[model samples]
Target: MRHATTSDGVRIAYQIEGQGPPLVLLSGQANDHHWWDGVRNDFHSAHSTLTLDYRGTGESDKPDQPYSTAGFAQDVIAVLDELGIDRADIYGTSMGGRVAQHLAARYPDRVGALVLGCTSPGGTHGIERDNEVRKSLAQPQPAARQALLELMYTPAWLATHQGPYNTLGDPDMPAYAKRRHLAASNQHDAWDILPDIAAPTLVLHGTDDRFNPAANAPLLAQRIPFASMHLIPGARHAYFEEFRAIASPLALDFLATARQR
Candidate 1:
């Protein structure tokens, strides 16, 4: 593990492994780098994968202050700069996808290819998750955890596999930090800047994604110029893990093809 000091003096914790072109894997809301542990190895053969804990999670320092997706992008930039990575393929899921939109739009030269999974474009243009889902999330303790598990995976997948899934996010994060993380992701609005992205892009989502909703996938793909969209059949919000056999290879191929172009 290594640390990158952000402009605001927050220490961002990151890890890099494997070989080939650099690929940054950004996790969802309140999650640390461990969110990608299940699928990180799947891309190692094709790309050097980097994962980081956002300011509020994992080993990163969490200050009592506001957070923004733009700020989160800066955290990523600081890490890349610390590692001397000029450009990389980006794979961001949920809240991380929101951060990737800002990164790709604001730092086009720093991105080679982009992959956004189970995320929204945000603002009024974006589709919000239903009230029922929100209510389930608001529930206390074990109930909320169970709701999250059900939301992240399909019934068939859950029935077939027993998992600790890493869906609970950072258990050690302070409530304030978690709230800050939520606020940062909630405030993300990149619709006006989507066209600014210069990288070849792939927007991925599970057809059955209840957390972010699959309807947002095509919207993101359509807004980003030359971006393509893929929906994994029967998977949920954690499609990258639930369907890595399809998602990982497709992203690697897209990144490889983009590099050759």
Candidate 2:
């Protein structure tokens, strides 16, 4: 594990692995760096990977204010700057995808390539979910996890992996962790800036994703000039878990191609 100090003096924790060109991994909402555990080894073998906790999650320092997508983007840029990396390929999922879009728009020169997974442009068709789930997220802990799990995974997956599902039922996470994550995620609206992304991009989503509809992928791909969309069938919002065998290789291939170009 390594550390970098952002301009605001918050210490961000990150892990660097593998060999070859550099690639940064940005995780989804409410998930720390460990969320990439399923595919990190595969990605590491192909590229030098950097995974970090976004301010409040994992082992990183969590401050009280300024937990917005734009702030998270600055934190990412700070990591790259501290590492002395002029440019890098960035892979972001859900909220991290929103950060990637912001980075590409605000600091285009620092991004070599981009990958967005299970995310939206944050417009009319962007955030679709049950009212109960939203209300639960705004409530408290443990219960928030229950509400989240309902929206994150499909019913079939929950039924099949009951033991593991139960394990994730009440994660040992802090309330402020959830608060900061939600604050950073809820206000994102990037639909207006899609056409400005100049880097080669890949947008991947699951056909069965209910949280952020799969149709949003095509909308993002259509807007970004140099972008392509891929849909994984029978996979839910957590498609990497539902179809790890397929999603892992596809992600690796997308990163590989993006790096080459």
lDDT assessment of candidate 1: 0.92
lDDT of 1 by residue, 1-261 (tens): 999998878899999999999999999999999899888998988889999999989999989899999999999999999999999899999999999999999999999899999999999999999999999989998899889999998888889979768766888999999999999988989999999998899999999998998999999999999799999998899999888899989888888898899
Each candidate structure's count of clashing pairs: 0, 0
lDDT of each: 0.92, 0.80
Where does candidate 1 have its weakest 10-residue lDDT segment?
161-170
Model 1, residue 35: C-alpha shift (Å): 0.4
* Clashing pairs in model 2, backbone N/Cα/C closer than 3 A: none
What are the per-residue Cα lDDT tens digits for candidate 2 across 217-246? Answer: 988899899999899987777787667788
Best by lDDT: 1
Q: What lDDT score goes with residue 133 in model 1? A: 99
Clashing pairs in 1: none
